[model samples]
Target: MSRYDPSAFPPFAVTVDLVVLTVREHALCALVVRRGEPPFQGYWALPGGFVRPDEGLAEAAARELAEETGLRAHTAHGQAAAGAHLEQLATYGHPQRDPRLRVVSVAHLALAPDLPTPRPGGDARSARWAPVGELLGRGGEDGVPLAFDHAAILADGVERARSKIEYSSLATAFCPAEFTVGELRRVYESVWGVVLDPRNFHRKVTGTPGFLVPSGGTTTRQGGRPAQLFRAGGATVLNPPMLRPEP
Candidate 1:
């Protein structure tokens, strides 16, 4: 047990926020909820809430993810990996980030495989998977800035996903359990916002040892010729990392 002297330091509340991304309609989109209460009522914000007395950072993150987007934490089994991919993103505790309280938010990054719909929960008035480009867009229909420091948090999450996938099997986090190379390419393209040479990208990923395992089946998700289906292999880190081009 630990003790805190009230006079030693000022108290601060803790919260958890999420940057949930997915490839939908071949675009990278983020999960956002409309704030229903004051401070930023009626504005869209990253879905989150204060940490409960008994929960850890990840627990609070998982709980908030479930409450906001109807996604749940991983169970004893690994099936939830097919549902959501979550990890710590960063923390934000700017003195002015929150107007109502002294809040320090531990942010998390989550990737969902091609999810197109979302249900709002907690105090959210509505929820949707809005295209990140538009949410960060200047003058598009979905191009409204998010409330609070969420826009900054989102930009960071996007960059993290973009960078991580280049050296990790994390791109699979944006694809289903069994996906074609073309499907996986689309995930990379959407996240990186770049069009890649199909043949070259195919060669690179396939050549990398243990990067993909053949599922002994094929599908024509891209139409025309049927493509071989594959699953994420045993390797977590890429042997020859897929590097993104300089911006």
Candidate 2:
């Protein structure tokens, strides 16, 4: 083999963008921030930042998440004040995606229960959660276009959440530790943008083994009548899977 030449390859930088999602007021919302600098300055975009040299991809993702929204990362095994389920989403490396440099973004998706209002951090001018419907509007008709290729990134993350819940128990990540069947159903509705038959949804979820365990309690939080509460069980993937309706 011949000697390798460092000059032969172009220099590039890596970044971590986050699609932090939650269900608020029966709507599926994503965290967004206003850019304070040029290259889409002042445009609303997904929360992200350049990866630091000392950190790995996951570490960089977690760091950026906290810096942008004050949210601490959590897996299925732990909890925090505003804990979220974090996982690698996808990578975007279009040659001209960034004008300033050759940049590759490794995006991650985070799902959490309804969160408190976010505080702007890092290079963000302001931060808040906006409904996915409003953000993913058509041709700038329903909503304003996001900065960079963030609109595509947000769409991918939204689809991932919508589809993951159909075959896995991951939807529970958007619910509190203890939640009612009605509350869980609403989570599905918000993510999928479709209404489900309440009785059918209740039966399907309860019948799925290891999907939920009764907390042996009841609440009238939603009003009308008391509903039994349950917590997410040990099952990660559903056996037969909860199929999505034809759209």
Candidate 3:
């Protein structure tokens, strides 16, 4: 083979844009930051930044996650990670996607419980969680258009979350350490945008082997008789997958 020429290929920068999602106030929300710099100044966008020369893609994503949301990335075992459930969602490389240069973004999806309020970082003017429907203009009212191709990225991430929870116990990432079946069902409802039958949901979840390990405790947090609390079990994949309801 002939010698490889570094000058033969055009230079392009790589960035990591995060679609950090969480269920807040009965709605599925995503973390967004207002741009403080040009190219999309003062406009809302997904939290992200260019990848550094020394870090890997996952590391870059985790660093950006912490810097923007103040949340740590955890190793997902049978359950969602300690702080969040993170995974590579997709890649966007449309030539005109970035105005500054030829750039490709490795998008990551992070699912976590209602995180504490975010602190802006890098070139972010402000950061907060916004309902996915409002951000994507699917909430009946006119919504805020995101900067760059972030709107598409956010949609993809949302769909990923919606689908994964059907066959995997990924939704637990949106719940506290110990949660009631009703709380877990609500997580499914919020992410899927549908109300599930409380009785049926409890039956199915409780019957699923290894899906949950009872914590031997109960609480009246939801108001009413005390509800049993449980933690995520050792089963990552649901045996009989919970199917989405027909529209």
Candidate number with greatest lDDT: 2
Clashes of each: 0, 0, 0
Alpha-carbon RMSD to native, per candidate = 2.6, 2.0, 2.2
Over 97-125, each residue of candidate 1 has an lDDT whose tens digit, in order, gives 98987899999888879774778888998
Q: Which candidate would rank higher by TM-score, 1 or 2?
A: 2
Q: Residue pairs in steric clash, candidate 1?
A: none
lDDT sort, best first: 2, 3, 1
Question: Candidate 3 regions off by >4 Å?
Answer: 74-81, 138-143
Give candidate 1 regions above 4 Å deviation. Answer: 1-4, 75-83, 139-143
In the range 61-103, model 2's lDDT, one tens digit per residue, is 8888789777777444433335457888999999898899999
Cand. 2 TM to true fold: 0.94
Instruction: Assess candidate 1 and give its lDDT.
Output: 0.85
lDDT score for residue 107 of model 3: 97
